[model samples]
Target: MQTQKIDFAAVQQAFLAAGFDLVGVTDCSPLTGARLARWLARGYAADMEWIGRSFRSRVDPRRLLPGCRSIVVAAAAYEPGRPPTDSSPGKYAVIASYALGPDYHRILRRRCREAVTQLQRTSGQPQKFRIAVDSGPVLEQEIAVRVGLGVIGRNSLLLTPSFGSYVLLAEVLMDTWVKTPEQKPPSRHICLDCRKCVQACPTHALTEEGLVDSRRCISYLTIEHRGPIPEPLRPLLGTHVFGCDICQEVCPANRVRSAPRAPFLPGSPAESRYPSFQELLRMSPEEFKEKFRGTPVARTGYQRFMRNVCVAAGNSGDRSLKPLLESLLSRRGDDPLIREHAEWALEILG
Candidate 1:
């Protein structure tokens, strides 16, 4: 049986029409899992043990899809028009730009599927494909770099010529072998000696070039960590109630941003970017669901979200939040995680 020829040009157009800003293709060569294995051995993944669990599949594309031959990497730029204001005492909390809108996982996955369907129609053959939108074990950034889409910066993010490091990546692994154009190797000087991202991290999570200690990363603490935040790190969290963006905000590569062709999701309200700490403190579980149902913030769940709000409130040094902290302490049914952080915040305010 002859394999149908894949039109690479048509493939690019299909993905671009599906809302991706950048597209590239590469062969499915197995990646050395050494770096990832070493990082995990050093416990850099913190409590997110799933990364280590999916080790084999993550390093080999064939493990994910039997007979995988080529990979289609796509990127969507989400850089905001303006940088978010620095969080301060008694002010609106800072949220990572990526999480401000509707969830990218669903948006990118649907778009990837659409692109695959279009490819099937254009080629007149059924193509076996799997879509991975940050949810799969596939090494997306590595694959993106291999396809000439971008280089990994010192901050460990894909820095594209047009979008810098402020883009979301997705992959379409297919059985159809697509020939990719030969590409010049990306320069190693993308980051140079600039350590702005490292210096800007309040928690010093960027311990070395392109390496992060997840235990100290604010993003990990706020979203992934499921227990009491270490007391010392609590103060460093400042007014951030969700994921942190300090590293990306300070990177020089992100300064000259390109306007995204269109937002991946509908424009989120201003409230999502600059949420009031007071309102978050008083947010009921039902309110939390209604407000963040389809957004990344919803993944934190009510208890953890409120726990983050408490830490931010405490850091704000805003005595006006005293009553709310007291109320949390008064409730017998309040989650201990929330109460512990609330108590710490009350102490900070006092």
Candidate 2:
């Protein structure tokens, strides 16, 4: 036990030397409290039934792995620093900044594994270590905040002062014990009745007291929803093709001082803060692959992405592109989801 405490502290210092901007460790006991239930009661998670599974494990990292003692929280920002390109109607669509580089799952998972290797070497105690990034049976944001990495914002995202919630979080859970850092809980909740995120949300996702309704959320509709996007939320989608950033864009936190938390964040400037729609519709498969080869958008496949493009194009209401929208619409005999949105776009355009 004593050896574990000493090794844990040393491993933490190593994490810093290894280039991690944020790290924290805490006991992995399951939280038996109202917060967990409240989070679920609000139904902010949407169709992500997986989030509802392994009920006991999601709240407690220790429950995630047998004999787990401590959890090491880690987060790396992925802001890519480029603004969205302006709208070009149906010919183009704007992808989120985080998707401009290598997939975060790969990036964060590798870094987490490396941290564990360093821990195992220096601590001289070999044990089970699992890495989780939006995976694992643990609640990342809740546990991250509990461990003093950051405070939860009204948007229900973990908001670090420097990274402004544009970060990917992961955890290294192992049976090896560590000297958990002593941190004063956050002094204040950063969001102060800041309705910017709530008001700016293209869809009414944010609700009372940090609750988010993922059903109406653009991120959910675009990526998680396999069927047709409800007509009510389509017009609210704005020009975002892959993910929506309107809420984050309007946050006062994003406007504050922020340096890139990860080394590879700088990139060629985006065409505009909002990419033109025309440029998106005209993006060839080759060009799309070249530009976003290792990006998160690759998971959705080209067909779904182009389908989103058509929907965004029709939303632009530029009657001049009616012919173009018609041409794209003609190609969609197999995908009812794409066809349905395209048809709705035509109505909005006319």
Candidate 3:
């Protein structure tokens, strides 16, 4: 089996034209998972057991695509605009910037497939390839670092010089070895003396060593956790209904003057980004599905979303929400998850 020489220049142009803000190639060397093993061993991954289950495939690309020799990593920048402000504190819910648009998985996967097709045309031969857009077991940030895309920040996010930590990552794995440009190794000391993200986290989820305890992470609790949120963390969650971004919001590295508008994920309207708490509390299952159908928030499902809304309403400190919370408790058929949070909110309001 002869390996084909892929034109690196052609590949870059294809990805750039496909709307990727950054693109680089690196050899498919096996990555060391000692750090990941230790992180999991200490139970930092929380309830995401799949991370441990797919440990081997994450550290080695060949495990995902046998005979893989090279990887093309690409990044798309999204605007990390300021969190919406309202005169009324508890009137609206806060959402992470990433989930305010169309799902990245579908967008990146389509763009990656397009680039692969362009590369096949340029090379004049069909190449075996696999596309990963955050769903696959591949460790995207590690590959991005090797490709000179960015350094992992103290918040445990990839912070690129151009877009800071607001870029989405995707990768294309190929069987044929490609010529990659010579580049300096990524620096590990980018965040020296920086503890803004660690200190700013309301839940103290980050460590000085750049590892995150997902169990204490607000984002994980709001979006991933299925059961009732712990009593102590409820007030700390504030009004964040879907995900939290306090860590990224306070990172010095993320203070870019401007970010490239994500071509795939168009800017959502203000109503969508900071939805009214009253509307969300009264939203039916069908309304929830219709409102968040294509966005990442839909992944939480109606039940958990209601649970988050109840928590947010409880923490709002607004007495106006007391009536809605009472209504939720009145429904005997309502999920206990929702009822529990609603009852907690009512007590707080009293």
Candidate 4:
């Protein structure tokens, strides 16, 4: 006996049941690889060499999974709570909303897997599918746009009409075709004349020309860059210890949305939500893992996180951090990344 055909309504229901905030589908089509090639050629991707190497796979989902016919795109809303404030005795560190909880890579993967399973079981024959999260070279935002999720804001993030720019994206590539949903106008194609995200970037990473120089992006420096942040951009980092949200924070489309009541995101422990610079500076490698194991903070590990904490301390302008910064500076350590940032913090404080 042949199995029943997969129902689009059932697949959509499965995604929603799996905690996805929005879901859309599109047939596989060629993406704008030439534009991406131009971006990479300009070195806008910074030190992320994988982007250049994986350009073909990123632009064409076919490179990721052979015989892929359709893509199911999902978006999970992450709450962008109040911005981090430095009104405390010392500096209060800022982490992006996406990194506050358990890493969404795992969450999205597991959920997408279950979603695919839910989908396959209903199909006429066994189905083949592959999961793609942020780490995947697939052009998720572009897929999201094609699938009618949202537009890409000036910050280079997907801005959903309901969730703003605070949504995490995931995709499932299937060997079989699914009915395509009606797509909204591409975000970049329909972007208004307003340049709020461009203007709000502290380091001018987001340019008036709608280009992002990732080397100067605070989020990239804090999380991805392993070396010492350049001295010139240190002050521009502000108190953001993990990731920067300035561009999204200033977006007008993000303001008028009816925010998700309970964001489809898990919450972090209270301590991790608002960590102290002194405590972070004192944390050992093991302790750092213990505190941030499943979250995105672990991606930076102890050395880089502490390195960022030192920068935040210096930028805090709070003389109280002097003793702690001194301790890091005076310690017998050859890790110049940490020591140099500590020295810069001291210089800033003095």
* TM-score for each candidate, following the candidate numbering: 0.95, 0.89, 0.95, 0.91
Candidate 1 RMSD computed on C-alpha atoms after optimal superposition onto the true structure = 1.8
The digit string of per-residue lDDT tens for model 2 on 1-350 reads 35456454676676655556778888877766355567677786676777667667776666668878888887776554464344344344566776666787887888777777776686665478788888677778777777777887777778887788777787888787776657659637879867788877768898757777889887777776667777777777766678777677777887764665456444725763345666655566676677667778788776677767777777766777666666666765456766676677777788
Better of 2 and 4 by TM-score: 4
- Once fitted onto the true fold, the runs of candidate 1 whose alpha carbons sit more than 4 angstroms away are 81-90, 265-270
lDDT of each: 0.83, 0.71, 0.84, 0.77
Best by lDDT: 3
For model 3 the local lDDT of residue 171 reads: 93
**How far is 51's C-alpha from truth in model 2 (Å)?**
1.3
Model 4 whole-model lDDT (C-alpha atoms): 0.77
Cα distance off (Å), candidate 1, residue 282: 1.1
lDDT over C-alpha atoms for residue 344 of model 2? 73
**Residue-level lDDT tens digits of model 1 in 1-350:** 87766867888899999999999988788987766777798889998899999998999999999989888999998865343365444577777778977899999999888888998887864367888988899988878877788887777788888888889999989998786678657646578788898989899888564878899999989999999999889888888888887788888888897878768644544566778877777777899999898999999998998888889898887899899878766862356887788888888999
Worst 10 residues of 2 by lDDT: 83-92
Clashes of 1: 0
Stretches of model 4 off by over 4 angstroms after superposition: 1-5, 83-90, 124-126, 182-184, 187-191, 259-271, 330-332
